[model samples]
Target: MAVTQQEIENRLWDAADELRVAMPEAQYSSVIFPLMFWKYLSDTWEHNHQTFLKENEALGLSAEEAHEVEYSTYQTFKIPFIHPGTVAERRASWSSILATVTQPGLGQRVRASLQAIETANPDKFSRLFGSMAWASEEVLSGEVLAAVMQAMDRTPKMHEGNMSHDVLGGAYEYLLKRFSDGSGTRAGQFFTPREVVELLVEILEPKSFESVYDPTCGSGGMLIASASLLKAHGGRGYTLKLYGQEAVPDTAGVARMNLFMHNLTQFKVEVGDTLKDPRFTKSDGSVKQFDVILANPPYSLKWKPWSNDPRALGGIAPQSSADWAFVQHMIASMDPKKGRAGVVLPHGVLFRGQEASIRRRVVNDDLLEAVISLPPNLFYNTSIPTVILVFRAPGTKVPDRQDGVLFVDASKNFIKAKNRNIITDANVSDIVAACHLKMDAGDESADPTEANSLSSRFVPTTEIAANEYDLNIGRYIKQAAAEQEDLGTLIDAYNIARAERQKTEQRMNALLAAAGIEGFDE
Candidate 1:
């Protein structure tokens, strides 16, 4: 019987629930995702293996011959075709390991099965399981592991025949969202809010067969969204090339699994610090460019800045914040001919003094196309207001609006939720429409910036330059006057003032210590 996507999602979450007593909910993703992926691989291989055997029964082929034929013709990765001759000692089939679940040292046997499968498919599954050192008797009891397996087993067969990739992929994404919600703020490093992702992908407008990249891809959500958007528009999603680099190994593994579950094979997700060691590069030893770039990088991360790196487009960003550094990398990676990029970052990138030179350079060069300020408290991590910066490669900008940037103030378009705010479908449509609006009003006499648009502005470059290149949305898209003495407003004001005061006090103490005056701090 066919099963619903929600049923599978519930079963998977139930399997994760079995581990609650074993570990904190925060670490559930690490355990649940790997087990789910292994089960998927095993189930898919077994289902296909059975069909291969049935179809070739009339050929009078030996087990070895059938195995060889089926693998060459049907499989993308290696899983043992049958309980075999020379490879008998390393029984890595899911059933083989599952049968021994009640036996002593089940953890070791489970580990062996995962290791063997990974070894057999080195190129596709190398370190794809992430860190499996936790799958031992010491860290996890065999009973708990078996319970998780059993709970997952209750779900409908995960093979391609029984479950569509859409069902399987939807379930996987459902689990990802659940994990992100359960894990709290740390989830920010691995997941971006889907609505935000939708907005960015819509703005970039990726096409069929175009290359899309996410330098700090968390669970590869943005890359997946690009393909999904094309598919939704009746384009061939599989033709679009997907690429990503993640700093964490486990996070990268999750991304790889996500792409596979989505049935995407034409993709590469490498693990490395993108700023320091970008994995995708050309033979000329330069960073490979892409047709579309999307990223929601770590906010205000402190990192070692390299002055000599050519990606440092507008001088080096201070070590205090790598916001501009990430922007520079994406801009450098944009295809010079037909590239467009969108990034989600704090509003600081728009007006921070440290990144002012980059703002000036990017503005003067006409790379920046628009700024859309989003509501505060929309992200799982920091609650500070964020904005989406859209940049188009030179010569790709709109002919009439190339001399200005569109600024959108969407800070009030979110629906209040219990934990965080949400951008509703209507809100997204309004924002996207505002962004893709006709820059030319069709009347040459009427100024494009004087359209009196609601919560939006088409500010000319000369006007921006007059304001010292400040692209803060407030500078152009002025807000309506309102009372600022409400409790929420006062609290937000106090937080901002307190944070700024702390920074000033810390700097003052540092200066006093440098001058050999210690008591000044008191």
Candidate 2:
């Protein structure tokens, strides 16, 4: 039977359930993702081996030679085993591991298999499984490990015939969501909510064959969103070259796994602090820029990388808040001709005092194109309101609204989810439409109210300069007043308060009379 997305999810969730007793929810991915990926590779290898044997048999090729050639030709990832040896010696695949669940030292065997796979594919899979301490009997008992492995084995077989890359990738994303939800703030280190990702990607509009980059690409969601956006626009998403730099090694591995699961091959995810040691550079050792940059970096991060290697433009961001430092890096990393970026940052970056100089310089350079304030509590890690700052390359052509920065007060546009708020499809579409129209208009002198139905307006550079280059959306877009219908309720409350005050006054007069204070009584 063909495997469906729902079935894949059900199997994955069941496997996750088995791990609940053995480990914390956050640690589940360390064991589950690697094992799931291993099974996928093994299943794919087996399928290719059968196909190659059938096709090459007519060409007088032996089964072993056919298997070898097929392995080299068809597999997206190579799973190493004792080739040309007895079947028992080649017992390193996922199927073999599943068969040995009842055996002693199951955790050690699993760890060894993972190590062997990493050894065989160093560039792609080195330390990819991360540190799985739970894979030890001291941490997770053998019985629990056996039960988890059995549950994973029962999952519907994942192979090309039954599952396409889209379905499998979707399942992988679903698992990522589940893990992030269960892990809470720690999950924010690697995952950005999908709705925000979609909004940024839509506004940036990455094209086919263009390079897209994210400096703090938690779990590679932003990069994947760009690819998915391209695919949605009738372009080949795989053709785009994706680049990402993550500060955490485990998060970087998760990002690489994310891209691989989505069948994205043309990508690089390096482990390093983007501020201190940028991994992507050109032949000249200068920062390599991308056509489209999307990032939701750690908000208000404090770092001193500038003291070691200062960026060329925009003075050093204060050590107290590295928000402007990241902005400078992004601006410097933009393609000189057509580079564009959409970065999510805390509201403080818009009007904070410490970052005034950097903000002024960036604004004077005309790189900042728009500021869209997002709803508060949209993130798992923090309830602070955030904003998306859109920037274009210095020399890039500004269409209609080039005279000033577009301010969008979309802070009220979100659906209340169980815990975190979400920007719905309509909200995303509305924001994107407003930005496009305002940019095309390019008329800061035009009536702000005429710009859009939403509370979006174009604030001229002159006004921004007068206001000390503050990009706070609220400074420009006025909040709507109370509705006429609400006035009735307000009037009723006022009348009730007056009646209570009158009654209190009468009682006070009575008390004054009883106390023989006639002069005080009205």
Candidate 3:
């Protein structure tokens, strides 16, 4: 019987369910992902080892020599065989570790095996398992660990012949989505909604061999989305060099795992605060620019980098909000000739009083390409409205939007999914098409009527200046007028109301005279 992709996912979720009883929902990924990845490595290594033995049996090579050749041919990760003093105590691969899941000190042995793998493959797997704290009995009991391992083992082995890359990658992505959904507000910290990521990648349209980066990559979804887009267009997605910097260690580890599981080897994800200690820099100490930059930074964060390594292109963002600070860093890091960026930020950044100066400088430089207003409640964290700011380097060829900016009023476009809203595939396609049309049109004076028909319009820089550089979509895109009433009918109704009032006043005066109230009658 063949194992289906759906069956694989169901089994993985069942394994995750075992953790739910012993750990918080947010910690599920830390434990489950590492274990699943370990199993994958173990299965692949065993498959290769068996093939090497069968083929090299007549080559007169020792087992040790053949194993060395097999290790050299392994593509993804390298796991070494254990060389214990006694054969009875020997433990080599992931299978050796799984054999002890039923032992007395299961947590300690599992942790030791993970540490050994990391130590053996320092270059590739250094700290790759993250600080999962899996060995601590206080964290996860031996009984729960054994049950979880049993559940995972029941699934089809993720070996080279048994599982394809696409199936495995899709299953990993499904687990990520499930974890994000269960994580609540914490999901927003490391996960960008898939539809939103696809929309940004589509707008950027990364080509073959082009470089793509995200300064604050959360679980590396945006980077993967770019490669997937290339693959969808019949290009070799693996050729693209992906780079990212994440502030959190655990999130960075997750990002690394995500890329590796997707079969993306040409990538680098550094761990550090991008604003304070940027990892990617040129020989001259300036930021190394990329072809396409995409990011969804933490909104309105307060940081103290202004005193040390401030990014003061437009103006220093107040310590209360680092939104403009991130924008400035991205702009400075863009490739001078072909660089472009798409960033997701709170809508307040467009018109906030504190960021007015930064907004003015960015607009005046003609780098601001478009401002897209997205639907509110689309994120898991908060219900505040958000916007996607598209930018092109000053020297780039953005004809239609060179002297103006495109405003897209997509605030009302979303599909309600339970408590949250989502931008569907149709919505993403429509938005991306509208952006391309505005870019190709290039006419600042294009008829607003035709432009407004699609919920988007081009606003000249002069008009934006007149409004004091307010990039709010509502300020530029006018709503249609309400239906009007018939003029004659309104006038007739007014006259009838006045006549009725006059007749009532006459009756009241008559009653007042009869009551001998002279002043009232007057």
RMSD of 1: 4.6
C-alpha local distance difference test of each model: 0.83, 0.80, 0.81
Candidate 2 C-alpha error for residue 472, in Å: 1.7
Question: Model 3: how far is 190 from its true place, Å?
Answer: 0.9
**Root-mean-square deviation of each candidate, in angstroms?**
4.6, 10.1, 11.8
Candidate 2 lDDT score relative to the true structure: 0.80
Candidates sorted by TM-score, best first: 1, 3, 2
Candidate 3 lDDT, 1-522, residue by residue in tens: 656889999999999999988988878888888888888877887887788778777898777877577777743456654545655354546688778777687777677667777888777778777886766899899999988988999889887589788888888888888887878777567888899899999998999999999999978999999999899989889989999999988788888888888889899899998888889998988889999999999999999846645457767888888898999999988898999999999976887666778889888898998898788888777788799999999957467677788887676668889868999888888788778774433232223353323367787888889978767666676541112233224545887899999999999998988998877743
TM-score of each: 0.90, 0.86, 0.87
Ranking by lDDT: 1, 3, 2
lDDT of 1 by residue, 190-251 (tens): 88989999999988989999999999998999998899989998988999999999999988
lDDT of 3 at 428: 89
Off by over 4 Å in 2: 57-64, 82-88, 308-312, 439-453, 480-522
Better of 1 and 3 by lDDT: 1
Q: Give the winner by lDDT.
A: 1
Residue 4 lDDT in model 2?
83
